[model samples]
Target chain A: MNDKPLPETLLPLEVDGVSFRHRGQTLLDDVSLRLGHSGKTVIMGPNGAGKSLLMRLCHGLLSPSAGSIRWADGKAASDPDVRGRQAMVFQRPVLLRRSALSNIRYPLALRGMRRQQRTQRALDALRHFGLAELADRPARVLSGGEQQRLALARAWALQPRILFLDEPTSALDPAATKAVEDAVRAFHAKGTRIVMNTHDLGQARRLADDVLFLCRGRVLEHTPAGRFFDTPSTPEAAAFIRGELVW
Target chain B: MVDGNPFAKALELILGLDQVLVGIVTLSLQVSLTAVLTAALLGLPIGAAVALYRFPGRALVVTVLNALMGLPPVVAGLAVYLLLSRAGPLGSWGLLFTPTAMVIAQTMLVFPIIAALSRQVVEDLWEEYREQLQSLGASRLRAIPTLLWDARFSLLTGVLAGFGRASAEVGAVLIVGGNIDGVTRVMTTAIALETSKGNLPLALGLGIVLLFLVAMVNATAFLIGEGAKRRLG
Candidate 1:
């Protein structure tokens, strides 16, 4: 019964040096950084800089080819119970051919939650996303924004402690993007640790409490949002912040 | 004069309620239904496994099932005939010339068709469903149910095709079951036996019943297939 919560959004977790390879080409190369358990951690990198792979590695979807990624709570991220408490929202949300309500209930079903509990939780989540009106609609037929909101609602219903989003707004229009951003900010307000990847600088500025900047599979800087945006210490960070071609 | 006689006699046999003809047609439907069920029991799981799992001999199993799809009805009849004979391993069951023998032969005829077609259905499903299911943290077994539901319409067509194949086949049941006059004769066998015995009216009547059955199964399958395509929302 080690239920003692850590102080100051404790992220006593350790990632000594983690890297990933696909077909002899490196995807993430010896990237190491640290973050607290709460607030938003934005991963910003140019295309092919391995931001998506890094997020997957953090979420335990893809195993790193080298080094270690250990959670400080002494639970392996791959454990079902631990993984159950973590949910990832993909760039292109994959939806089941079911009603919107059922999509929200799916993760609960996996955890073997009670039927009544699942129904109430799903309804609550849908209402939060302003999707209670579309509860019985087929999730596959929803618009891009609606589907993304449903994805968020489903993830929220899981009560995830660590939420990973891989460019959730990249596929959305500006208005739809604003809607999803508001949902992310609301989740962050409730103390969920957010790790998201994005190329939208304005969005990163709006949502990021800290930044993890990467270039060519390596971490160039892991800095506070205010300082990193004002005067980047590293050359790569400076070039990236200035909107210069880093790829 | 003989053409009118044959036509009138066949109509009387059908409209006047011939008991033997009616009994044979009913037995035919019952046996084919049971055979299709048995084929599904044997073939659908095998097809799904071959479609989903990547074991050592999966390719060989699929190849054999595909080759068996064209197995001659007479050859299947001969094989079942030998297996149910007095000297065979299953002879203790005393199944020969009984309705059971006809069912076994017909099941064999339909098994390969169901297996081969269902393999196609399940393979396509795997391509479409595997990643989505896996991402949802669904296990291999649970993922299969989702995949199966997605391709259920295709599996439905496979089953109807199997039933059609089983009901229309003659050589297997005739050779294996011997199509005794009262006990084992079905629509196809009774039609064959009556035709050879110059009972043109009875044979023609059974033929009409068969033509009606084949048309019905095909029409139902096509309708369901089209409906599935239209209702994908």
Candidate 2:
């Protein structure tokens, strides 16, 4: 039901020479990549590859130690509208302790939407996510799958131009993972750009329009989904594709 | 020193609503409530600031607060006494030997209790909500009220704890209040005066009332906390 026309700004998400360091040790080296305005771009990397950190940097939740991240035609990511136009869901869904209804309403409230409109919007989101019956329940008491669905509903209700998800289904069972995959597909269908991180190669293959393979904080390969699986350019990515440790 | 059992006589005073007993109880509530309310007004912001922001000397501020939580009531009373004394810096206000001075002393006694406890509560809630709220576009300062509201049940316990401390304290109020008969005496001070004068029944009666008052406050806080936990969480 996303009839609302997309915003005019088509500034591709650009990460130019971004690096992050903590305690005098580099976590992400001079990594750079550009993300298109649509479809699922799954970030696949082994443990400690800085996948989540990079997603955070892209979402404007964290700043890089060096280099720049810009979105929407050179628009500063800190711009209120820019920030408002994107949302992120972490590995563990962070729902408010309020009712499921209120969890979605909170971000709408933050957007300063009027009570009547936001309430209806939130209710609609709950219905859309098959959570309408549980709307009155405390969000924290929901099942993991339900909580993840609620988190997605909360982000989707914001009508974000882009959604960043970090290992969204890492902790889910098969059925729950499938449910989450369906929701992610719905977001993609509605034309919301999806940039996600996952350790699940099969899930990545299923949902990814493209793959950004990272190894030890470096982008080993960023290629189309079909090509990445068939012929990864770097040995690190090839080894990772074969389920072997790169380092 | 009494001809009759003091406990029975004390119960009679309470049941009969003795004027002196009532006066002591009323004054005790007034002074302690004012003190706790003032302390909360000052403490909540200080507690929130310490929890939500990082700065130089933060560790020292927290250390002093933790230490102040256990500050002896007598020392606080003495400090307030000097401040309100004729030759003291605040002497011109003429607050010494007045109820105002006792309120000042109790506020000083419990401000740290409220601040320290609230800082802990708010800090824990902030830790849980920080990244989520920041991603939602709430700056650290903007998130304080939200975090405070969400942690309100815990913060209410801190206030109740402050009230308990202020109400039960005798040393601070006694020094600055002077326990003036029919003037500035509160429950704790009146009980002390009565005991010193060998009026065991009256003192014991006031002590009973003080204990009951504290129980009621703590029970009410507990019930509200449970209700909030059930309703909000």
Give per-residue CA lDDT, model 2, range B1-233, as digits (tens).
Answer: 55456667667877888887788788898999999999998998789889999999999999999999999999999999999999999999999999999999999988999899878988988888787887877777777777777777788888898999999999999999998987788888888888998888767866887888889888987997898688766
How many residue pairs clash in model 2? 2
Runs in model 2 deviating more than 4 A are: A1-6, B1-6, B85-94
List, residue by residue over A131-166, the lDDT tens digit for candidate 1.
999998878779999999999998888767778899
Task: Spell out the clash pairs found in candidate 1.
Answer: none
Candidate 1 Cα RMSD (Å) = 4.1
* Residue lDDT tens for model 1, B1-233: 24535556657766877888778878898989999999988888778877888899888888999999888899999999889988888889899788888899989989998888778888887776554455456666666566666666778888888988899899998988788887888889888987898877657766776887778878977887776555444
- The CAPRI-style docking tier of model 2 reads medium
Q: Fraction of reference contacts reproduced per prediction?
A: 0.08, 0.50
DockQ of each: 0.30, 0.56
**TM-score of each predicted structure versus truth:** 0.83, 0.92
Docking class for model 1 is acceptable
Output DockQ, candidate 2.
0.56
